[model samples]
Every structure is written in structure tokens, then in C-alpha cells.
Target: MQHTNILIISDIEGSSLCRDYESTTFLGRGWPRACLGMSKDVNAVVRALYNAGAREVTVQDFHRTGFNIFPEIIDKRARVVQGYRQGPVPGIGRAHGATGLVMTGMHAPSGADAILAHTLTSRIARLEVNGRLMTEAELFCASLAPFGLVPLFISGCPTACDYAANAIDGLTSFPLHQEIRGSEARAMTWREQMAAAAAAALKSPAGRPFNPKGPFEAKVTLRKGSGEAQKLAARWNLEAHGPQVTIQARDLNRIYLELVRLVYLNRFTQHVLPPGLFLYRIMGRLGLAWIRRQLKNLPPSLR
Candidate 1:
């Protein structure tokens, strides 16, 4: 029998244990506790896969900066890929004989009611590939096509789970929470339940790959009032109409590259900012906290 190896791609927003922006934001008030919960969730699935007889398991921290998952608390049996990386799939290079992919802590696309819902980044208001609305799960699944691996399991909010299941045939999805309104959601299951579901999904047959045909056309709608949209359009030669930008490519890889450029265009500031700039950090924290509070106070209908 062939030894099965699996790759786990994890995010933090869809974690049932995470309830607020502070928990998912890096260096925010509840970030440490949220990181611990995210680590435990990843570790749970890792141990389950090992118990189910998987020889090797690798985890890719697919969240902000790609370093959200705590290395110290992760399962020793599983190797983890952390930090920022570039490619069709950031932080994930060659699949390396992995038979399956598991997406954990995923949320719905932008404008959805799932907790911290956003595609690629909060800067994007909407994203469409080849005229079809694209989600992070779909993009990652297509990127893994060259390696012949498929998304075997996904654990996330209900909307995200449904999206993945609908996009990939035979894909198993475990819902950690159901979004009630905007960032508000109710946890549906505990960490142990999620682990069991993931292991069972992995042991099942491999899911079909969701590989879209080539000659992809990507349409990205930047968030309203964004200051970077004009600059991005000028730099990339993208066709811009108001907040929307379009990139035409012959393949998915190029489309992915274009989207990456748009998403991280302003991220370079982090590299130049002095480490001792405590005041700036404090201001940013306050601003983010205020925005989160406003979102929390929004009516359910508006959310």
C-alpha cells in the first residue's frame, strides 16, 4: 500500500474558537489566545491524520504574514511551513508527493456574512475569475492541480464549507460555525469534533480537482474609498473603471500573480517601518479597534 501524506492549509478567521478581529489580528489584544486556539485546531487534525496511519503531514500557515500558527505548540510529527512566501500559492510550493489538501479555518468570500470574511485581503470588495466568483478555496484548489493533489477536506464557516463542497466534487467539508450576521457566528462544534471529521474526510477517496479551463479573466473590485486602487491600476496597466480592475491572462498562474501584486502592493511599509515605532503601532491598534467596534454595533440587517 502507498503511504499517504497530507498537506494542511490553515487560516484563523474561520476558527470557531475565534470570535473577534482582535483575536485574528497580529499583535492585537486577543491574538495570543487566538493563535493558541488555531494551533490546537491544526494539532488536532495533525494527530488525527497520524492516528489514521498517515506517514507524514505538513501544515502551511496560510494566514496573515503566513506565520500565525504557533510553531512551539504544533504537533512534532508534522512539519510546518511558516512566513511569507511568493508563488501561485503563497507559503506552499511544490506539493511534493502529497496526496491530499485540507483547508482549515477558512471563511466565506468578501461581502459574505461569515466571520472576518474577505478574499485575499479586505482591500478586495469582489473577485471574479473567468466570469465565475472566486473564493480562496477555489483558487488554492486550482493552483494545486499541477501536482495532481485534490482538496480532501475543508473545515470552516458554513458558507465557506458550502462553497468548497459545491466547487469540488466529492470534497468533504466540516462546518465549525454558522454565520449569523456579519462577523457574528455561533460555534457548531468543538475542536475534537472538527478533528474527527477531518480525519474521516482524509481517509475517504480523493476529491476531484476543480481545474478551470485556461485563458482566465480576473476582475477585481477594490474596496470603495481605497487609496491604492489608482496606483495599482497605473502600475499594472490594468483596466480600471472606478473601483474595479481587470486583469486578462492566458492561465491561472498569471491570474494568481496579478492578484498577489494587487493584494500586497502596500505591504512593503512593514519592511521599512522602524521596529521601535511604538506610537505608530499604538495608533494602528486603536484605529482597528474602533473599526471593529463599529462593525460589531451594526444592525443585523446591515451586516
Candidate 2:
């Protein structure tokens, strides 16, 4: 494990204190608090990685808008990548010699009865590759394969942990309970427990890169009555049946980028995406600053 470097991909739905759809998006009633909790949860793991002798740790904010975690609260030792990026790997660039990846705040794929379950976007009912339901953890792990990075660990809801464990051999998963039925004092222990478990899992990590069989077929089923499928199919020149659109590719990375384009971009937007992403990054920073201001204005008891 000498000179080990770890990459952490963080999402909102599986953050320690995030509980519902509302908490997963900006300006939702619980969004600010959720962001704070996510920061502390990630900070604990950052400390643990460093203590475990990791030479470098990089965190990618993989959730919506990619601006969820509060940088001020995260461990300064780790490099944090905010917002989205475009490349062969999509939001995840090349592994850049990182030894392994650690995904935090992950959730189950769409159609699962897990906390805030969805893949890529809630607009899509589900995403399937080679007839099997897809999860972000699986996609992220597969994206890093060309760079020789394996999945070291994951922490999230039970369903999410199970999906990742089943998909990648020898991957260590820590599941935070879906519900904590007790006093707030009792409920607050999950973060500490998660930190300890994650640290323990990384003490001696073992796993191979996830390389799913390709010549892939992907089915994107948009939610019923959403009227999005038709628009997307028309935009991409793909055929749509009812609410489902199908995509085929020769490899996982190609399929992954296709899914990204399906969910986030169209022909016109693709042309202006660079500028759009820049503006979005600015908006994300402003949104986070606003959240910080709101938190500061709250009474100390609530804070």
C-alpha cells in the first residue's frame, strides 16, 4: 500500500443525514443541512484514509449539480473536484495513477426501494445494461478500469452496498441503516460508525477493477407520462417505444458516455456545453454560499 492514492466519489442520497428526495437537491427544505452532514461524513473518511497511510486522496462531487459537499468542512488534505467534466469517462476523468476508488453517499439504482433511489436522473424510471439494472457504483468502477484503479470500498444504504458488493468481487461495503428509530442522540451515531468501518475496510484493501462484459445494450426507461422519452429520442435520432429508449455500444465506457448524453445533453446543448458547465459551476458556488449564509443566520440551537 505504499504511496497509495484514493479517489472518493460522493453522492447525496447516501450521505449520513440525508433521508429523502427533498434533501438530495438544492433549495430543498433539508438541502443545506444535508450538505453539511455530507461534508462531515466525507471529512471523517478523508482523515481515516490519511491515517491509513494514503499518499493522496481526491474527492469528486458526483451528485446533482456536483456542488453538494461543503468544502469548508472537508479535510483540507484531500483534493476535491467539484462540478462536472467531459471526457471519455464523462464526469469521471482518467484515474491519473490513483491506486483505488472509494465511493461514499451512494444509493440503489432506480426502481429499488432504497433511500432516494435513482440512476443518473429521476426522470428515467430505470437504466439497464446487458439486461441487468445498473448502479452508479458499477458505472464508476468500470470507468476506472482502463487506468488500473480498483474499487476499494463503498458506504451507503443497505441496498446500495449490496449492489456494489455483488457487482465487484471483494469490494468492502458499509451500509448505513435506512431508518434510525430512536432519539436524535442515538441517531447521530451513524457518522462515527461509518467512519470507523470505512477506516477498517481500507486498512488492507483488496479488489480488482470492475470490467463488465461489453458489446453492451442499454435501455433507458423514462418515467411514465413524463413525455421526455419522445423528446430525447427525437433529439438523438433514436427510436423510442412508449417511454423506453435503447442504446447499444461496443464497450462499457462508450455506453457510459452515451447514458450521460442521454440524461444531460442534447444536440444544441452539446455545442454550448462548455460554456453551460462554466455557468453552472458559478451557480453552484453561489448556491452553496447562500446555504452557508442561511445556516449562519439560523439560531444557535438549530445550528
Candidate 3:
């Protein structure tokens, strides 16, 4: 049977970017756990695509530092792109060229007040382009639209699901948990979510993505202590706060590249992690972490 070239953009290991978790605010923490489960999520998606007549499955380990996808656990046939610095930067089409794509363990844009509401950094107060709100996931997915690649499946916490369903069409989601207050409240087991994801993904097909023109308004508000605001302002005149700066972009990828550069600078000034990472691996870590935690919590009978 021939396999389709399906790319899964994951941010499981990226859940720590929220910096809200008691465990992962610090760099290099909580990523290993997320990567393990992200590997399985990749497998589950691959299982479905292979069963549904896919030819290839490539999972982008899009999370922190961008290189956390554990190749040992991921299906040997699937390709994993890890880390941000080593990637084309997280934006649409960066993961394009696939027959179809899946965005797993995603979250809402930093503009909205979802649990971890920050685009690139908590330092970023907000990201707006041409009066529309923008999140890293949205920017990343929108980037894919230009490549004519459709995102078919997405999984993560409820917020992640809600974000994907609203942003990308024909994209189904597997919501792992509902956040109440701060901690995980109503959660779905990883196996259950994966099973459900596989079952729900059976009927999906590729759809057109959002490919809009730029020179669009781009704005970002940074957190206190992050000079990213001024640095970004120097690039383009938009807006600035004590810890924020906004810019306008004629190119989405251009803006994305700018963000990537800024993030690297931030890391250099702060915590030192891996050197080369890609787009897919950075975000996959976050959602994958949530998925695996459920698997660990599963009762023996359930397993």
C-alpha cells in the first residue's frame, strides 16, 4: 500500500513555554517527558494515515529549542524535525509539502487569555497582524496555507482543540484535558485521546489554508525585562510598552524569522539549551507531555 506524505506539527514539549506549569518554567525541564508521549502520538497518527492509505508521515517536533522528538520511539518511517534554531522557523508552510498535516498538542494564540497566553514569549504581550489576532500556531498554520497544504488533525488540551477547530478547517482535534483554574481538571487519557483521534481522523481530507497578503500590521507586547520590545521596534515602527513592541510586516515568513532571531537572543541572554532545533520539535513537546501524563496515569486495567 502506498503512503501519503503527512506531516504532523507538534508542540507537546512546548507546554513548558507556558511557564505556568510548576515544573517547566525553567528551560530543558519537562521536555523529555513530553517528547516520549509526542512520539506515541506521532505513531497513533501514523497508524491512522497508514491505515487510511497514506504514503508518508513526517512529524515536526515543534517545541522548545525545537529538537525534542525522540527518534527511538517515533516510527522509523516517520521523519522528525526538532528545535527552533535548526528549523525554517515556526510559521505556515514551514511544514508544508505534505499531502496533509496534523497539528498536535497545540494551544490558543497568545492574544487570548487561554491558560498559557503568550505568543513567542511571556515577554510578548500580544501579536496582532492587520487588526487580527495572531498566535504562534496560527502564524505557523497560516504559513502552510501558501503551500496549499491542509491541516487535517489536531490534538491537545481543550483550549488547543478549540483554537485549531476555529483556525484551520477540516481539522479535527483530540482534547486531552480541560483546564480549570490552573491545574488539569477534566482530562482524557492519552490512549483514549489517541484512539479517539485515530477514529475521528478516518474521514478527513485536505482543505485549502489561509494565505493572506502581508505588509500587514504586526504588533507584539513583551514582558517586563525583555528588551525584545525595543529590538523589534527598531526593525519596524508599530508600538511599544514597558515590555512590548509591535511591528508591521510585508511578509509572514519574514516576521516569523524575526521572532525566531529574537527568541535565540533571549535564550543566549538567559538559560542555555541545545544548539540546533527545528520548528516541529519545539511545540510537539508541550502537547505530547499532556498526552503521556495521561498514559502514565492510566489504570492497569485500562492499559
Candidate 4:
């Protein structure tokens, strides 16, 4: 109806299709980059919003390390929020401060039939705390709804786009590709997805917001046999009860940040196979001690 300030939270880049090194069904070498949709989707939405009367826009490169999306490729006119080490919550804060939000390049929850599909980590089975099914898109949109920021557009794989649209009604979703099997996809060009996303985003009658009634519950289910199970068990200072873990976030900021930390800590395991590859790459293995120390030493503002 009027000019708006938009924010984009996305996992812009995913590694090249595993080079077919892991499984036989995996996508071919560099068939595509996971971040491509994010880069393209955001650009499309930015242009659409600007035409639709957006005054300004900020794109939050909200991944674990917060380092996706090439600057040159991203909409130069929009501000980019990067880096993973931004304290507790890695990505954007409350959308309470923004006019609108958009999510792209995000995959489905761990169980979805998408390439590199895992909720928090390969170890996480599901994360549905406080009654809400928590995907990065859900968690982020939920946090923003309270602040009056509606997620208006989304683009990614089939499961990913559906996951987002279901979470936020009235929002436009363009599924870039369909993950037919692990590492394999029935390709949908980024241009096609972006065009659809742009058309949908700029369409006059926006869809209804799938805003859930709150008092939100935070839950997490990790992969069955990943090392992150051990890490979360220790980080939250709880018992390692197989692959499932649960936690609570009282407010939007808390919920969003906690999810980031979950992704951040779980980052240790994302490379060799699944996300757990981050485990070997992390310095000091990013153990529970670090989480404990930080939790114990958190500042009043953060806490």
C-alpha cells in the first residue's frame, strides 16, 4: 500500500553439488550453488519493492558463518548484514524495526527432500519448540510478525518455498528447484524463480499472513547420529538423549538468536558429510565449554 523498508534473511550460498563425491545420486560438479537463489531472489524482490514504493532495504546474510552472497552480485543499493560471530544471535534482530522481510535460498527442515536438507544440523531431527514448527524461515518470520514486519517474498527449492509460504500467508514463494533425491534436483532456472518471485511479490493482493498465535514454544530435533547431538547436550548443559533436543525462547529476539546459535554451534559439522563437516573445521571444535562460558558470562543486554 505504501513505501516500505525491507529486510532479507537468507542462506545465500550452499557448496557446489558435493562434486558427486559423497553419494552416487548427488548433483554433478558445480551444477549450481545453493546461494544462487538467494542472490537472485533478493535482487528481484528489491526491484519489485522499489517499484512498489519501498524507501530502503537491508539484506541480512543470515547464515551460520553469515558469509554468503557476493557483494557484487547482491543488489548494490541494499545494505548487507554479514558475519557469523555477531555474538549470541547471528542474524537480524527483531523486525519490529523494519517494514517488511523476505527470505530466500533457505532449504527445508532437516527431513525435507532437498539437497543438504537438515534443520539445525545433520544431527537435528526437528526443532519445534513452543508449539511452532521452527524452520529458519518460520523462526525468523515469527520473530518479525510481532514487530509488524511481514515476510512478503520467498524463493528456494520446492520444500523450502512451501515451508516459507505455509509459515507466512500472503507471502509470495518461488521454488527454485525440487530436490528429487539427495544431491539431485529437477532444475528450475534462477531466472524463472526470480521472475516468479518478483511477479508474486509485486502482485497487488498479497496473501494472508500465516501468523501463529503466540506464547511460542522452541523445539529442536537433531540428526540421529551426528556429533552435534553431543555438542548440544553439552552446550545446553543437558543429557545427550540420542538425536533430539529441545529449548525455549520467550520472545522473538530470543527465538531468532537461539536458532542462530544453534546453527553457529552446529557449524562445526557441515563439510565432509552433511553439516557436521563444520566440526572438523572449527577451531577448538567449538565445544560446549564455549557455549557454557558465553551463557554464563552473557551481558545484561544480551541476556
Candidate 5:
């Protein structure tokens, strides 16, 4: 059975070109190239999904500014969703009619040994749910559960893939090793293998949506002093323990939104969210234009 609409959530930390913090940051010189690598990775999977009988594909740029993917480079058949949205999920808006989801260019959660490892924010020392270290893949899956979308495929660093697979049983994943960067030939081979595997996962579409039963407990450990944690705890009315703050909620979706608030918002920002988002959208357009110019000057292989 062909999934009518499939969503591919793309990040940057696990993309082939991302080597460190500089590669993942929007202002860094390597960021444009990193975006190109990510766009290519997403396009490969998008093409594979189309060939595997998917009727429609949606690619959501889920990196820092949500403007990393070069829309001009990805498969035209896929609708690209960019920038942040104020919602339960925060970034990607509604699930629409998507029956399944794929995660690519994802990295390991906070406290992991993967390159550019961090949860929602670098300030987060660690994030735990039900005593287990939680991953963004798990959180994304749970947030989309109400839409009845199952996690179909994931491609990322070894640690990320392993954690995602463990979180969602029977989910398929491709681990793009660090050694692949040693040569262009190896990178191409890795992309081919990942695309084929992603297609197969979409065709089979195994497992159910990750809707773990709750009352859920989220423990967020900050990297620095307890002051920040105490402030956030007081603001959210959560429990602050040392440098950590704990949130309890009956729904995973709620927990996700709260986590977003913790990572990206404050009292002043929260009140001015609409204007802030508008400003961000304008900035994103300018940044994207700059990236276009950079891409044009680069060689075909890099683009």
C-alpha cells in the first residue's frame, strides 16, 4: 500500500559534510556546503520514496534556523517546509495527511559522543524521560502519534541511528560513518545504500506510531549553574533540583511543547513571539539568498 503523504524531517548535524560546530552553524563558512550535503541526502531519499510509490513527500528543514536545506537543490516533487511555527510540535506545522515519517541528518541526543551532540539546545547537559536518555527522534515520533504517522526510516550518525532504533522497535536506519568523509567515492556509495534502504523502509512501512503511555516525566539537566534551571522552573512551575528541572505532563505532545518553551522562549520572548517569528522569517529569506549566491560560485560537485 502506497503512503499518500510521507514527511521527511531533515537536520544538519548528521549530514555527510558536517564535521563540527562550525559546520552546523548558520554564520560559519562551512554552513553553505553543509546545507548542500544535507539537501543531496534528503533528495536521494525523496527520489527513492517517489520511486517506491509514495504519492507525495514533505521535507521539513529541522536544523538550527530551519533554513539550512537549499530548496533549489532538493527533489522538486517534495514540498519543503522551513522556519519555525508556534504549535505543539513547534517547527513542523500540521502533519497534514502523512501516514509515515522519515528522519535524516539527525545526531545523537545530549550527553552522547556523536559529533555536534546536543538535544534542543547546547545548554542542555542531558535530557531524560522515564529514566532513559531521550532522543529527538523519539520525541518527534510521539508528537506525531495523534496524526497516526509511524516512523518509517532514519539515516544519521551511528549513535543517533542506534538510539532511534532502540526507541522505535522495528524501525529501519542507515548509519553514515565518519570514515565516509575520507573520500568522495565512499560518500557516494553511502548515499546510494542509504537511499535504497530508505525506499525499502517506505515500501514496507512497519511498526506503529510511538505513542508511549503517559503521564510522562522529563528531566532537563543544564550544563551550567542552577540559576537558569531555577528561573525556568519558577516560570513553568516545575521542580528544580540543582542544575536540573523536571516537567510532568499527562501527554507527550504537551511535554514536547513545554520542552520547546524551555529551550527557545522566555517571558519577554513568549509575549512577543508573533513579531519575533516575523523577524526571523525576514532574516531567513536574506540568509537563503546569500546561500544561493554561494552555491552558484561553488563547483558542481560541491553543489
Candidate 6:
């Protein structure tokens, strides 16, 4: 069957009402509230798309564990894609025939001076494709291009909006928050404005795909203290250039997969841990907290 689906890729750090590590972290103190805010922001865009005559909407939970959104609170008309899955994109697959892609709650790339800014993970200090610096949005857009989908709109902070506008030609964007200084931002509570902007964007002409001509050369710069870079360099047969690892691939799919493998390789245990092993969960949380604290203490210039 032919489908006119709009794929909404949602992240937490760029949500309208989100602020601080507690809001973005899965098990942090303010996570519940952040989840609710993210759900509402997604639903607003979903409803707007439906109202604008979109046949279907799919909300991809693109945050931690791919399960941050509350299923019950999201728009019932939209199907939700949750959990970690293997694909060119985390929640996207070959079966999706999305007419447009909407990146909701997306933050800026690492080193971009936005609230909670980082690329795929805190460990990745920089990512470049063919020596061009990339934002997470650009990477995902390149992945979706094979499916003939183009980015239509993005909702996030002002930095995110500017990044999308600059990266994807003719793309529309709504800034739900504006960064004041460092991690502080002023939230824009106008859901109606966001909805209207998104609806209009979907109806407008699609933006140019961000795909780069391949064979692709990717360089990943790891944070100074992260040991994962050495491990990844050995596993991928890549050359370690101080803090950076260089990987070459013939296509975007290989590049995407390699990056994912590097970032989440250490967390494989979390998926296999038995639910009843509550002690392991506590240990994992403490370990993650320690790692984050260390990342925070890294020279601000590198972060």
C-alpha cells in the first residue's frame, strides 16, 4: 500500500519545556516531567500534520533507550517506534515510506553553544564526514535520503533551528527555546505557534537531502578521558590519531552503523540485564553518573 507518513524523530534536550541534566536523563529526578513535555510537543506536531491532511504519522522515540515518550499520552492517531533496533537510522527502517521527516526536540551539534549540546553521545567530541563537521540532524537526514525522504521541519532551540536551516536547504524550523547563556534557555510556551509552523512546513516543498557523495571518510574525535576511542579504533581497524579515530566507508549505511556501534557498544549489557536485578540497575546508574561527572569536568573548550 502507498503511504504518506510523516516521520517525527523526537529527542528530549530540545523539548519546549526541558532544562538541565535531570530533565534529559532517563532516570534523573525530573525525567517524568520531561517525558510529559516531550510527549505533548510531539502530539502537537502530529495533530497539526493530521489536520493538514497527512495520512499517517510515526513518532520515533529517538532519545535514550528509545523509550522516553509516554505511549498513553501521545496522539492515538500516530504509531510509536520505540526500543533499540538495528537499521540505517535508529528507529527508521526500509518499510517506512515517509513523505517528510520532522526532527522534534533536536539540539545543536557538539560544541555549538546550545542547551545540553552533544552529538550522538557525550564521549564524541567531534564528528566529521569527508572533513565536513556534521550535526546529528545532518547525519540522520543523510540516512533517510536512500528512502527518498527529505527533512521538512525541525523544532528545538534557536541554535538547533539555525543549524537545520543552514544544513538543509528550504527546510522550515521553529525554535521552542532560546539559549541565554551556556546551558540556560528561555522556553517558548506557545504550542500553537509550533503546530502552525510544522503544519505549514509539511505542506511546503521538501528540503534538499544532506547526503554527501561517497566513498565516505569519517573522523571521530573522542573526549580526552574516554577509553572507548582506543577500543573502537582497534575493532574497526581504524587508525588512532591522538584523540581522533578515522574510518573510511563506501556508503552512508556503513558509516552510520559504525558510529552507532562505537557509541553504544559499551551499553550492550543494559539490554540483557534481567529486570529483577535491581542492584545492577543501581550500579549502572552510579557508573553512568560518574562518567557524566568526568565528562562535565573536561576542559570546556573540548566539550
Among these predictions, the greatest lDDT belongs to 5
Candidate 2: worst-modelled 10 consecutive residues by lDDT: 179-188
Candidate 1 residues 18-68, lDDT tens each? 668887776576655455567778988898888878888999877765666
Q: lDDT of each model, Cα atoms only?
A: 0.71, 0.79, 0.56, 0.53, 0.83, 0.71
Off by over 4 Å in 6: 1-3, 179-189, 206-208, 225-227, 266-303
| Candidate 4 segments exceeding 4 Å error | 13-38, 84-90, 94-97, 129-133, 179-196, 199-211, 214-219, 224-231, 234-241, 248-303
* Tens-digit lDDT track of model 2 for 111-221: 687667888888878888887778888888888888877787898878989988987886888887856411234335877777776666665445777887779988899
Identify the candidate with maximal TM-score.
5
**Model 1: lDDT to the true structure:** 0.71
Q: How close is candidate 6 to the true structure, as a TM-score?
A: 0.79
Question: Can you write out model 6's per-residue Cα lDDT over 65-84, one digit (the tens) per residue?
Answer: 66667666677899987654
TM-score of each: 0.79, 0.92, 0.70, 0.64, 0.94, 0.79
User: Candidate 2: where is the Cα deviation over 4 Å?
Assistant: 1-3, 181-188, 203-205, 224-227, 299-303
Clashes of 1: 0
What 10-residue stretch in candidate 1 is worst by lDDT? Answer: 180-189
lDDT of 3 by residue, 1-303 (tens): 121677777765223112234323323344334444455566666666666666677777665545545566765767765544333534322554575667766665667767655666656666676675676666676666656566666666566567657756676766655432112221224544564665456456545555556686565656543466666655544466656565556877667666655544453532443432233354556645554565476444432
lDDT of 2: 0.79
Off by over 4 Å in 1: 1-3, 178-189, 225-227, 266-303
TM-score of the candidate numbered 1?
A: 0.79
Give the better candidate number (4 or 6) by lDDT.
6
Model 4 Cα displacement at 213 (Å)?
Answer: 2.5
